[model samples]
Target: MIKTIIFDFGDVFINLDKPATLRELSQLGDFQFNNSIQDLNNQYEVGKITTEEFIRSYHNLLPQATEQQLIEAWNAILLDFPKYRLDFVKHLAATGDYKLILLSNTNELHINWIKQHISFYEEFKSCFDSFYLSHEIQYRKPNSDIFEFVLQEHQIQPTETLFVDDTKENTDAAQKLGVHIWNNNPKADDVIDLFTSKSDLF
Candidate 1:
């Protein structure tokens, strides 16, 4: 029986435009901004660099742009966290039918942004039995090791844990570990709809 649900924060709970930062950076530079932005993102995820360092690297690259402008542009990807999702997740937690866990691949700046902007961040997080952030864990998803780490830490049977993520690759990785998963595409289907549809199973 599935006794736990693992959720990916960005795109799943909190909406994020994965490419918005790079798109904004593209507007600031003359050359193609694709590869460099990706490299910076990878470095940030792997804990090889800090958010300040990442922002400064980009700012230095685009000397014409002010630091505040670059920061705002980078943060634009984190748009809004809807109240409905929080209420839904809270409902799931309130039922006491399953253990809730949040596993997200994020860094300091994004976290600080959420803490400042989302009024319910603390309450929403409190609903979870465990909250794992990649930066704090020093590991990110789509990496099998991180998935294995969570399974071991929680003592959760892979088959009894459902992993929901917005990215196919991440979900696929978890699925390989024998965990049930849902690839939640925000544009195609909201997570609320998925939860509602799967209510009978729960």
Candidate 2:
């Protein structure tokens, strides 16, 4: 039985337009969504660099865009955090039957935007027993170490936890450690359906 739940933030609770930023950037230069970009993204998410430095990389690469334009382009991917999902998680958290954790691969800029735009950001956050942000924690998902860190920190048994993520690679990594998982399809699935869809686990 699952006594603990680890959820990925983007696509799991908050929606993301994963390609929006890339598409917007492509307009300014010959940007190949290649290793260089991925490397930079990884560094930013893990808090290896400051948000200014992260923004400067884009400004340097796409010289035509100003800092404001770059910041806007970078934040285009974030969308709304539906109220119903917030309600569902809050109710689940209130039950106190399962340990609730939110693990997200995100950077300061995105978080800052959420805090500014989402009115209930703090309230939503209070529901989690533990909240791990990649930038703050210096760890990102799809990496075995991050999953291991969470397990060790919470003193949780892998077999007794359920991890829900929108990405297959992330879920695959967690499953290797014996954690049951839901690789939620963002296009068709909603986090609000967690109880009904994964009823057997509950």
Number of the top lDDT candidate? 2
Relative to the true structure, candidate 1 has a C-alpha RMSD (angstroms) of 1.8
Model 1 stretches astray by more than 4 angstroms: 34-36, 199-201
Could you tell me which residue pairs clash in candidate 1? none
Each candidate's root-mean-square deviation in Å? 1.8, 0.9
Pairs of residues at least 3 apart in sequence or in different chains that clash in candidate 2 = none
Q: Write the per-residue lDDT of candidate 2 for residues 37-119, one digit (tens) a residue.
A: 88998999999999989988888889888888788888999999999999999999999999999999989999999999999
- For residues 89-139, write the lDDT of model 1, one tens digit per residue: 888889999998999988878888899999999999999999999888888
Q: If scored against the real structure, what TM-score would every candidate get?
A: 0.91, 0.97
List the global CA lDDT of all models: 0.86, 0.93
